[model samples]
Target: MAGRTLIFTGPPGSGKGTQAAHMRDRLGFVPLSSGDTLRAEIKAGSDIGKQAAQYVQAGTLVPDDIITGVMLAAVSRQPTSAGVILDGFPRTVGQAEALDDGLAAAGRKVDAVIDFRIDDGLIVERIVNRRICKNCGATYNIRFCPPKVANVCDRCGGELMQRVDDREDVIRTRLATYREQTTPLIEFYDRRGLLRSVDASREAPAVESDVVALIEALG
Candidate 1:
């Protein structure tokens, strides 16, 4: 079965990435994470990645054009017949419009947009307790999915560390930034009647179930 091109948008700690992985495993949607993709490009020292690296090194946001360029290129490389799980990108209305144009040119369009909804307070709590495996990039929430050995990764023997952005203050600021930038993007898809919301405050499996049901309903 051909999968659907899906966009998963939500607050930083809202489990969109986690749920996207579930979709990829069960539904065959190729997971294209914007952060990971950009990092790869930067590591490769590609021209576009070089520009993105400057912004990162300067502690500033990468230009929308560069971001859109990376996204379009990534999308173009994917199989025309397969579905994609977009973890990040189209973070604003401008990118969303650009994505629409890009997909249209490829004769494919986003089949569904899933918004994982959670309150700011809960998000802060979740992020603060979250830890990552430095070696494998696997995430764990101390309150929900803690590792058997404290401060150690279950998957890879790597030491678990809290991300700087997951600190309480940073999370609050990021939340503010997200609300400023992404609210309109949410409205954009909602108006198109392609947006569905799944409560992300629940457990991972429960949220995954809801996300899958919503996508299946899209058919």
Candidate 2:
């Protein structure tokens, strides 16, 4: 079967990535998380990854050309695979248009666009207090899911550290950039009647319920 293509979009720290992860598991969707992809690229020291790292560290959007090329290549490879979920890709109208063109060429289209909505204030608090396990990539929040030991991962005894972008100042910058660059996507997809909103300020399970409801309705 030709799996579905889903675009998950929201401001930084709105738990959109988390929700995408949930849906990927529940629906057997292949997740193409752009942030994770780019981070891996950076780790490998690819040419484009080098370019992206500079912008990412500055809390700025990587230029549209670089981001679009990377995502398009990723999507092209998955045309015949399990359902693919786009997490944190196509943050601007230009990118969306490019995605549309690409999919049209492949006889595929976005099954739905999931828009996670939350206030900027909550986003700051959520991201700033978040920590990740350096070894296993397990995530936790100081306020919500504090670990058994501070600065330690409960699962693997890995050290927990704040992501550079997860710092307070960088989080605020990401939010501002998200509002400026990605917010219009809400209207962009809404005009096409493919946009669905999930209130992401709540806990992950509650948000996942609404998100699942939306995706299931697509059938």
Candidate 3:
């Protein structure tokens, strides 16, 4: 059987990445995160990374070609029968089209697009209360998943600190950008009958179960 490809999308604090990671771990799928992939390339300072950095540093969208190239390369690395979970790509309708085109060239298509739904208010609250390990990058939430010791990582014994960008004003701005840019992408997938929304305000396990059931239904 051909691999199942799915896209997980949402605002910053909506747990889309967590759900995508769950699907990847439990189902043996590769999780390809556009942000993470691009960041890696940028850190490596490759030619393409430098090109991407120009756009990123300028606070503009990386040209669709560059982003699409990264996504295509990631897909090429995976086996034909290995499902792929896309996280944090296709932020705009144009990127969505680019993804479809790239996948078509590879003789694959997106099986489903899972949009995690949560309100902006809750997103702000969730993000502000969250902290990350300075050493190992493990994430914790003050309200949801506090560490064993206060303000420290349970796994790595690292200091946990809040990101500067996680402040309320920055989060609100990100939400505004999401509504402006990402909503159209959601509509694009909905038009193609590939969009399924999961209530992301629920706990992680519940959302993961909903996603698994949705993919199984697609089969």
Candidate 4:
């Protein structure tokens, strides 16, 4: 049987990555994140990796064609039964259309697009104090959900550091960019009848439970 596919879109600090990871485990879907793919490719030092490195280092988006190509490649490698949960791609209407076309060519279509809705002010507050473990990528919000120990990762005992992009000014710019670009993509999926908006301001488990309910409802 053809497996299910889901897309996740939201503001930078809305916990899309965390939610996607949780859903991957709970739903048995392969989590494919564009940022992770690009980072892996760049680390591999291939031709495309070299090309993506420059943009990533400069804190700019890689070109759409490159990102789309990478996404298609990632999806092509998955087992038909495994399925996929897409994260951090198709940030615009054009990209969404292209994604649909690409999936159609592969005899697949998006089953749902979960949009993590959170207030801009809350997003700013969450990101400003966010700490990430460099070793395991565990994220903690200093203000709300700090690690068990100060400046340390509970999972790996690694040092925790705030991401440069999570600074107040940078986060504000990222949020502004999301409003201008990613917001339209939400409408695109909604119009296609594949969008599900979930409140992300709650605890992580609560958010995950709501997403699980949405998936079950889709069945």
Backbone atom clashes (below 3 Å) for every candidate = 0, 0, 0, 0
Q: Please, what are the lDDT tens digits per residue for candidate 1 over residues 1-219? A: 444688989988788988888878998888888998888778888788888899999999899988887877777778888889888778999998888898888778888888989999999887799999999999898998899999999988899999887899998998999999999999999999989899899988899888878988887
lDDT of each: 0.87, 0.83, 0.88, 0.85
Which regions in candidate 1 have their CA more than 4 angstroms from the true location? 1-3, 44-47, 131-142, 145-163
In terms of TM-score, which candidate is stronger, 1 or 4?
Answer: 1
Q: Model 2, 1-219: lDDT tens per residue?
A: 567889988886788877778877898777889878777767877677788789989999688877876666667667565678899888889889988988877667888998888898988887888999999999999898999899999999999999898888888887888889876877899999998888888878999899888888888
Please list the Cα RMSD from the true structure of every candidate, rounded to 1 decimal place. 3.3, 4.1, 2.9, 3.5
Locate the minimum summed-lDDT window of 10 residues in model 2: 72-81
Model 3: residues >4 Å from true position, as ranges?
Answer: 42-50, 53-61, 132-140, 145-161
> What TM-score, to 2 decimals, does candidate 3 have?
0.85
TM-score of each: 0.84, 0.78, 0.85, 0.83
Among all windows of 10 consecutive residues in model 3, the one with the lowest summed lDDT is 68-77
Instruction: In angstroms, give how far residue 159 of model 2 lies from its true place.
Output: 8.8
- Give one digit per residue, the lDDT tens place, for model 3 in 105-208: 88889999999999999889889998999999999999988998999899999999999999999999889998998888988999999999999998889999
Which of 1 and 2 is the better model by lDDT? 1
- Local error of candidate 3 at 15, Å? 0.8
Higher-ranked by lDDT: 2 or 4? 4
Model 4: lowest-lDDT 10 consecutive positions: 68-77
Query: In terms of lDDT, which candidate is strongest?
Result: 3
Give the per-residue Cα lDDT of candidate 3 at 111: 93
Which residue pairs collide in model 2, if any?
A: none
